[model samples]
Target: MSKFKPEPFISCYGGALGAGVDEVGRGPLAGDVVAAAVILDPAAPIAGLADSKKLTERKRELLFVEIQAKALAFCIARASVAEIDRINILQASLLAMTRAVEGLAIQPEHVWVDGNKIPTWRYPAEAVVKGDSRVAAISAASILAKVTRDRELVLLHQQFPDYGFADHKGYPTAVHLAAIEKHGITPHHRQSFGPVKKRLEQLDLF
Candidate 1:
């Protein structure tokens, strides 16, 4: 992929700030859909802000702290696993993003979401493909979302060590599949997800 080049900040709202939003955990087999909204402080610009996936865990963690401290406004929110199963992951992810922005301490005039689809919201919002990499605020939101979800998974490992949520982060990896097959699904697993659904059917759990 080409290196991200952010376009100039353009907000048509009446002297209001623009919040960048992004979601993580849409692809996970388990866990809530986490999202973040960040209104960056132009004066406190953070270096090394890029797509969260492009950075190492250590780097991402460092930036996560920096963003929390330096951002003009930031909010982290999530759609529950039950909501993900009921509304589906796409809608759940969007809902999470919307919630993140809505929860921000500072109200924003516009919202820039990192994706092709926009959530149902009254705020002036637009979606940009790969905005997480192209937009600094979106990148910061991505880092916050990713780090928050990863930390949740690590904590979940304490309750269910067999799934190795700390390692796979709820993705359908080989180890995760093996564990699911051997131990069955947990309440955390999304029943709507294919792997979890198939396993539930196999075990006649559903």
Candidate 2:
């Protein structure tokens, strides 16, 4: 169990219908940026809520299931590689988070986003420096987004075994960079990213 206890939405925002938003895969070289919005049910308090990065895979998987089952409402959304290339990773991340919050079954009175910036939206929202660790709803949202994106990368690994998506989850690791140098870029790779763009330029030179 984690020693950190996340603050409840009702206590932080003073709202019964508050949603927490978070995004994952922003730094990955491949795959879509995934986001999630979660409205926790105060009646069903989940234990051990913490930042997704702080939790092990097994723990996150367990919490993913629990959050889905217990949350009042939750939505997972994504911004495609094309969208990321068209707009930019940061904008795409915020766009995905916006989609997540908009897709929620129950609209929230206020939204708490996990980062330092909130997307352009109409709902009352505030950005928390480390909401995933400090806010219960944000922790749940982070778990959902992280688990969802990780699972997609695992699936991508099956198709491109040489890239080892399952191992590094598409981040620009040395092995992934080597694979790009050897196998070249895939359709799933974000062409706008620095590493991918440079690799593409190098390939063009050949």
Root-mean-square deviation (CA) per prediction? 2.2, 2.6
Candidate 1 C-alpha error for residue 156, in Å: 1.0
Residue pairs with clashing backbones, model 2: none
19-101 per-residue lDDT for model 1 (tens digits): 99999998889999999999998889899999999999999999999999999999999999999999999999999998999
lDDT of each: 0.92, 0.93
Model 1: worst 10 consecutive residues (lDDT sum): 7-16
Q: Please give, for residues 100-202, the per-residue lDDT of candidate 2 as tens digits.
A: 9999999999999988898989999888878888888999999999999999999999999999999999999999999998999999999988888998898
Best of the candidates, TM-score: 2
Clashes of each: 0, 0
lDDT of 1: 0.92
Candidate 1 stretches greater than 4 Å from native? 1-16
